[model samples]
Target: MENQRGKGLSFARRIYRPRIIGLGIGAISVFATLYPLDLPNWTWALLVFNGLVWPHLAYQLSTRSAFPYQAERRNLLYDSLMGGFWTATMQFNPLPAVTILSMMAMNNVAAGGLRLFIRGSLSQFAGVLLSWALFGASFNTQITALQIYACLPMLTLYPLAVGIVCYRLAIKLSEHKRALSALSRTDSLTGLLNHGSWKDLLHIKFHKCQQRQMEASIALIDIDHFKAINDTYGHIIGDTVLRHLSSELRRNLRHDDLAGRYGGDEFCVILPRMSQSQALDVMERLRQIFSQYRHPQVPELKVSLSIGLAAFSPDFQDPSSWLNAADKALYLAKNGGRNQTANNAGKSHFEQTQMA
Candidate 1:
């Protein structure tokens, strides 16, 4: 269910923002009609500021030239100036200025929250609400009772709608982004994470072990004679074998366990908070599971796996070293015989093979 939902969110990211743009245009049109060209000088200036100048300035200061986080900050500056100008205009002609400012706030919240959704940040709405509140407070501070009472309701209503729309949009975008990220990091054919995920996971685990003195073991598992399975039984059946193991490994392992496709017919597992002996037991269980199963197409799908595991230690300062030691153990397993498990607690007295 979770994976299906993630896929659906991925589909939504491609469609949501462009749809919001149409809504934005309609909102802007309404704002323009409410504050026509007949307004007083102060009101005219405020309309131009909020309707055109602010967005243009925000684009100039932001967009392509600055980093995302930096651009978000610059947006606040532009919004503040626009909101201030709009608030002063509201005292002169309270109705139109309020509507224009509301439109601006709504647009900001929409765009900022959408961008934030993609980038995995949540603080973008701060500018929208803050600017609205600043304008509202400034109006209340300077105006007499009649104007204040007339404008305050419009002030609250517009910002509230903007906030709500933006809030919902932000959540949708966030979910979509997360799902896309997950998809990018995982293998499409099998459920396991991909090569990129493996590299990233290794780096993260190594850093954790360095900082906290945690024990970690990694298993490199390869289906023995996988090429023969593909050549003899056809690639379709071979793919089925790989898919089946991926499901089995994911089901068998603990929640903290991570399995990734290292390459063709090869998979790697990172087991946090586990000793070398424990890793071997897990590998042995995998061997038994594959042995017990048979493929209908091949009939004799007696495929065996070779596993090489290594415990992360101080000498394993780099990710390459851990992989090297694990690969060496793997080589020994393949050399001695197929269907065996090997592990190194630290650097073995023998040699460790360097991996490409």
Candidate 2:
């Protein structure tokens, strides 16, 4: 299901909390190794500067710094290389902290490789393995089976632990984005697709119809004397009327049909696999349903929809032209009598309406 996949993807992109945990471990090591042993003045100074550089730069580059993909990659690669040089400077230090720091550098490199190569799962795994092997071999002259076992525990679990945390966060962030997107494309009052999305829907549906040679119809529905409702009651009541109509429209429409709030008190429907006459019958059903949408708060509230049908056939040039034909019939319905439907297949007025 889309919902479940979307949830999984969300988890993939969250903040890696282990980075902070690792940094905290580093901080603890600083006091245990540096303050107690008090290494050379130069070593202390260099360590302090390197400490500031790694966290600050990592936070800024990952969160704030935006660059083209290739360029960002090159920068990360540079950091990974410099990391080695930074660690090698303290090889002569008496403290084993530098030794542990070097192992941490392997971590930094593995983490960097993961960040750089999104699709290259093989490359990421290999890089992590190599980093771990080098880290083990560096501490001990020869990498024995015991050393390899010690490295395996962290190497196998670190990425997984951090990855799960991030994956969970990404889902929540994505939901926020999806909700905002939905609001933008929706009419708040009607809770239906607004006019903004209509053009795109029309094109997409047109392609579908053309491929399958599926009969499709467009209906323009305008609520008659809707202005009177607003005038007699309040705009608040008028808004409630609109929302009520929208709910019924959504319930009545087929899954494939699209209902949109075209503008103030005007609505439209796009019904697939329906000819003009069949569409008219559907509109009448909708009309009969609309006539009953009175409220206990406003008993006088009454509205009727005038719909026009246009079927896409060989005569119609395209979906846009077909919609225009529907609009022409809508005009006729409005002028002739309110709450009626007209079919405008192969009619000259449809072409004229398109030109206008």
Candidate 3:
């Protein structure tokens, strides 16, 4: 309920400024038309209330309602009705009547598209009939010079207010789109790139290497005995360990490097422009540092990494072949011992002695 109220309040505020600008200018036009004829004291008072007080009241009505959007739509219909009442009361004066009706129609369309525009027209017809019954259906065809000048402010400023509202809405929509795109690409647990996005990046990187004949490598890293850790320390601590590892990877890797969670207990990295030997050194260092990571929550628990490195090869027909080589090397590293770095250069496997 609180969240709904907040949204209501926000919606009210977004509509408030435009309503003020539009109605304030409209009030001037209506007052000019009303001033020429001698209307009753209560009628003038009603005009004042509509122009000066109604905008704020309508905003409050919408914000305080259970469904703000619906309340605001009703308010817009009320605005259209008022426009009609004033038009009829002015005796259909050419300038003010047209100006008022056009502005109200614009507001209706902006508020709820064609459907609300038609609904507002019906309300306006009702107001016209009410005015005819009350005031005996008068007509004043003449549009005095003062009234034309009065109508100018509504013609100019109301459109500007509507434009500003539309621009602000566009900006908010763009921001939402960007935020959603980032969320889709990111891993929920570790905040790394998820498996599919990482794979997409790997494909791009493979193409880049093939085109430029540049040296690059990919590493598949696994947390050794991760299931045992989760079973012993609980999944919560295991999650903490994963988060810590991702943090370390973020801290240690270069800005250009890409790291991703390639599913449970395994992460992937792309090392561009690095030779096989350089990739080995980097992976070895990462393994050493990760093996030394001590969780604050469980200080006695020790964590280690088993990583597999595979340099890019022209013999590979596709990105998956390159990835498969890294996966095989990762298997070897896991099989050799719990903590080590194993390398696969072309078809040959290196000894799993790269350990700290």
Candidate 4:
């Protein structure tokens, strides 16, 4: 029911403003033709009611309907009916009749595309037949100067209103598309890039370093004893610890650094334009920062990180090979001790900076 109302409001807003503008202009267009014929008093009153009051009444009817979009669509068909009636009553005067029918068609198309256009056209035909039966059918091709002036507002202003509405809707759709793209690439738990997005970035970074002959490093990080933490304090507390590590990474890492949740209890990072030594320093800082975090929910609890560092190399065949090096280094860190940073290159001793 709420959803229906939301749709109704959206339909109402789209139709209301334009109807007000179009009908106000339409009134002028129709009156110019009718005035010369010296329409009967009741006929004149009906024309004024339709031109001035019907727009507002139609808006109210559609908005209050259970299905607003469908209601607005019906209103558009009625507009076509009224347009045909006016055209026939004016004896098919070329300028005013054309303006009325064309504007009605435009409204129907805007509301429901080609299907509505056909349906509304049929409704207009029915209205023309009814008017012919009641008031006699005729044609007046001549359009006076006053009628032409009245037609100008409908021709120019209504199209502008339609264009403005369409432009604003396009902008809103573009923004929604961008937001959905970001959400797809991001992890809901840690607010970091998800596994697939991270891997794609790694592939891009790998080729970049190869072409530019520039230095960069990759690190794979694990939360030491993560399963044990979950066992001791439940998965909720374990999640808190993971979030803490992610927050620390955001605070310590450079703006250009890319970090992502690789999988359960593990994260990956790419440090661009940085050597092995700089990478190790950054990882070491991250490990220390994570170890110092004491959860407010469990004040006695502590967490630590085990990190592996690997530099981009000409010898590596692909991004997977570089990732393998970091994984191997991470294995060494866990084996050497639960909480330490390890570098896979050359004879660099495993940094045994463990925290209790």
Model 1 CA deviation exceeding 4 Å by range: 1-152, 345-356
Off by over 4 Å in 2: 1-151, 345-356
Q: For candidate 3, lDDT tens digit of each residue in 15-103?
A: 88898888888999988888978888988888888888999999989987888877888888888888889889999999889888988
lDDT of each: 0.65, 0.61, 0.88, 0.87
Best candidate according to TM-score: 3
lDDT of 2 by residue, 30-89 (tens): 333334332558655655554445545554454433332333344344443433433333
Report the Cα RMSD per candidate: 12.8, 11.3, 2.5, 2.8
Ranking by TM-score: 3, 4, 2, 1
Q: Provide the lDDT at 27 for model 4.
A: 83
Tens-place lDDT per residue, model 1, 1-356, is 55644444432342233223322332343243335323446545555455555544444444343253355444543453444344343332445455545455444445555553333222223433444554443333233344445454445555565566567768988999999999999999897899988889899998998899899899888899999999988899989999988988988899989999999999999999887767777888887787676887667678888888888888776988988889888887788676877776432222233321
Q: What's model 2's TM-score?
A: 0.60
Question: Model 3 lDDT vs. the true structure?
Answer: 0.88
Cα error, candidate 2, residue 205 (Å): 2.1
- Relative to the true structure, candidate 4 reaches a TM of 0.92
> Which segments of candidate 3 are over 4 A away from where they belong?
1-3, 346-356
Better of 2 and 4 by lDDT: 4
Cα displacement (Å) at residue 353, model 2: 26
lDDT of model 4 at residue 139?
A: 85
**Collision pairs in model 2:** 10-170, 10-171, 11-166, 11-167, 11-168, 12-167, 14-166
